[model samples]
Target: MYQAIVSPQEDKFIAVRAGQQAAMQLPSAFYAELADLTDSDGVVPDWFGDAARQAWGIELADLPIRDVLMVRAPSVLPVTYSRASWEINKGCNFSCEHCYLEQRPFAGLPLPEKLRLLDMLRDMGVIWFEITGGEPLIDQDFVPAYQRAYAAGMMMEILTNGSRLYRDELLQTFVVNPPHKITVSMYGASPETADALTQTRGAFKSAYRGMVAAAGVGLPVEVTLIITKHNVEELGEMRAIVRDLGLPFKEYGSISPTYTGKGTTLATQVPGLIGKSEVFQGCPAGHTSFHVDPNGFATMCKVGRDNPISLIAESPQGLMRLPAIADAQMLRTGGCSGCKLSATCRVCRPMARVYQEAKAPLNHYCQHGMKEEP
Candidate 1:
């Protein structure tokens, strides 16, 4: 019979081998026990009834609980989607000093190529599609590309600076067909700081207006604050603003050091910009998600997007063989090994590369617990 072991450290359930038998090879005893725990009519405990309902998504009253449990078998493969973020364009109108893509070369996949990539994602059963860039909205293909994915039954997410979302009509379109989530990069709370960082006068006002417009359309919005030396102290203040706006807050500790464009100069100017907390262990790129650049190069993280993994060929098995296809097993070492705060840690491959390149150890800018670490 299979034994359910609850991980004391992570609050997760794992099935282990029991009685010299593989968990899968065990007889119906395990399922029988589960059925007994979920049975009604005073046979199973009430507490276990709820647990069984959650795990199996079946109401006890709906079926012969014992017989159903015995006959039904759970799939061996875990239920998860291949998470991918596509950089639709490499150009941005705003030039934020802290931007990893600012002043970098602008490139975009041709329309035909983009469509092919979408088909590939659909075929691979990638339920989640994140469209980002220097600014994805700037691309002429943004609307069409989004529609393509939406038609393909994929849930979409977008990351933008909120500059191009100026008109009510554009905002309305997003509301009518809302994506899973929309994240806006808020450079600063005030126009002065924002303009200074973006190196664009009056751009902050446009961005703010865009965010307000987006909110009016009933689209769920999240504010992403990129923390830097110039804005680290204002994080709490930024959180307050996000709360006031009725939006979720997603704070990035710092820009990745491996990022081309203004990142190189910014890192040099702001030494110790990153927080020193080793909240996360190693890179969680492949484990949780993957990134695809405009050129169709897939990688474990955005920083590594330019470095090619295998190309997006038309086969699932071939795609799985790509070096950038991050799996849970691949992320168990290096920065993630024995990490005390792995649950709350955000250190991914990009951040680790930044830490290694900038400092011998993890950078203070990106860590939560190592704020005072040398």
Candidate 2:
């Protein structure tokens, strides 16, 4: 495995180390020169060695390019997105009530097609990649697909439930090729509460064991405390558990309807814990980042999935339409079209539409509901 990666992040070129924040900006000419080199070439440019030494305190002058660094192939496509998230599969071992995905189908592209999808992502110059799922680690092709993307120099992060993190196979794979981070969701501190929330017997034991195992091995692990009505009382205990484990944790109390506008998931929301979201600001969902579903359809983001383009059928060329698609979805259409408080509305137009479609209570997302807060 290579120690560093040289790739394009939008308009700029950078050399970044996997699992580390260390990075150095590279000149456009230097990036061009590296991009021109064939993948089989073993030549290590002299400037890279000096720069790497100066920046990261590593010696690479005498090593072959392939041995020292993975030089990512520059893209010729008009779109220059550097970040992307992939849903490896929508299946999970535990069935959580507040999951955003209404349907947790155990299906995705076959291994060969999954590899092709990874290739497309690499060709699109995606440097920061997130592999998520109902539980990504449960997927059969996850290891091979992960290895492929990591080899291609994409700094990867896995969003998982941590139920399978204790598995030796996964630990070995992660030990070999460390991901930039592994984020695990903590539902509750106790088995009774967690199992009830997830509707799975022994769910807490497996997940807690996995988190402890992963942390014991020194994997880059972070915890997300999923606060809901079922487990809200255990908030302090969950924080104490995470603190004992010596892992960073973030609390998430707000819940939203399913991506397909199913409102059932919102019933689990702890209204008292739902904090007001920040005011709407512009984002770079399509211009600098995108999300890919299990079947290889690319959308601006996970929430604003309007017109998805098939990355498998059209390949990277289809990305040319993404920016326009993203921009169109951002328009305040429907009920929000002529709203006076559009500027101060916390939810984006696409999210607001979904909330409306779900027939959710106004206070759940709309500014109208926020104004009624006591």
Candidate 3:
């Protein structure tokens, strides 16, 4: 992996340390010079070495260009973006009750097609790439796909359950390439509660082992404590486990229906946590970033997956239609249209639509939900 990445962010340019947040802005002339030197396989310029050392305290004065820098080419596409999330596959090793994916099929594009999709993402100037799934680590092509994105100077993040992270090969690859973040969900503190929640024997043992292994290597791992009725009793123990591992964690108590409007998953949501989310603030989901499904279908985001554009058929050109699609889907229609509480509504239009379709009780998503709380 390269030491740093010099890339375009909107109209300006920036140089950032690999897998870190340390960044320095560049002048137009400086970025122009770097662009001109893209093909030159020589030493990193003396000026860059000084800037990097000053900004991030890294030494790179005499390193070869190929070794020190991955200079990303500016995107020429009309619909340019700097961030995206991809579902490598919807398949997972464990069957969690709170999973939002109604169908977790173990299928996706072939390796070559996956590579082509990654290249297209690179060409679109996407730098912050999130690879998630029912569990991303379980995908067969995850490593190569991750490597390709990392080589393209994208700061990668993986969303997984930590079940498969104990594998030596996967751990070594992560240590070497170094994702910007690896977010894992902790089901429970013990095997009985966690395994019962996931419906997989030894689920807690495997997940806990993986977390320990990742922590031992000092990988950038963060835990998410999934709070459901099954594991609610172990909340304190769960927090203690993550604290003992010296890992940071956040709680997720408000579960939602499946994206396809199935309410089965919502049954796992904590009653007290319902309607606790922050009021609806506008998002930049399709304007500045988007999501891609396993089969190369691009959508506004995971929740508002209406009128998906086939990235395989249109390639990067399909993204040109996303902004308008996002706007259309975000409009407050159907049950939420012209409501008096629209200003204080908690969920987005697409999300509320799903809950309405699922026939969920008003106490789950509506502002009326808060009023119903006794």
Q: Give a tens-digit lDDT track for model 2, residues 1-374.
A: 78888887877899988666678998999887776653656566788888888887888875777666777777887666799999999999989999999999999999999999998788778999999997999999999999999987899999999999999999999998989999999999999999999999999999999999999999989999999999989999999999999999998888999989999999999988553678888788988899999999999999999999999998888989999999999998887779998788888887888899999998888777665555
> What lDDT tens digits, residue by residue, belong to model 1 across residues 173-229?
575556767889987777777787788898779888888777766676788887766
**C-alpha lDDT (0 to 100) for residue 140 of candidate 1:** 81
Order of models, best lDDT first = 3, 2, 1
lDDT tens per residue, model 3, 224-287: 9999999998999999999999998999898988889999998888887888899988889898
lDDT of 3: 0.89
TM-score of 1: 0.66
Give each model's whole-structure lDDT: 0.59, 0.89, 0.89
Candidate 3, residue 97: Cα displacement in angstroms equals 0.7
What is candidate 3's CA lDDT for residue 364? 91
TM-scores, in order shown?
0.66, 0.92, 0.94
Point out the worst 10-residue segment of candidate 2 by lDDT: 35-44
Candidate 2 TM-score versus the reference: 0.92
Give me the runs in candidate 1 sitting further than 4 Å from their true place: 1-81, 232-237, 260-273, 276-278, 281-284, 305-307, 310-317, 323-350, 358-374
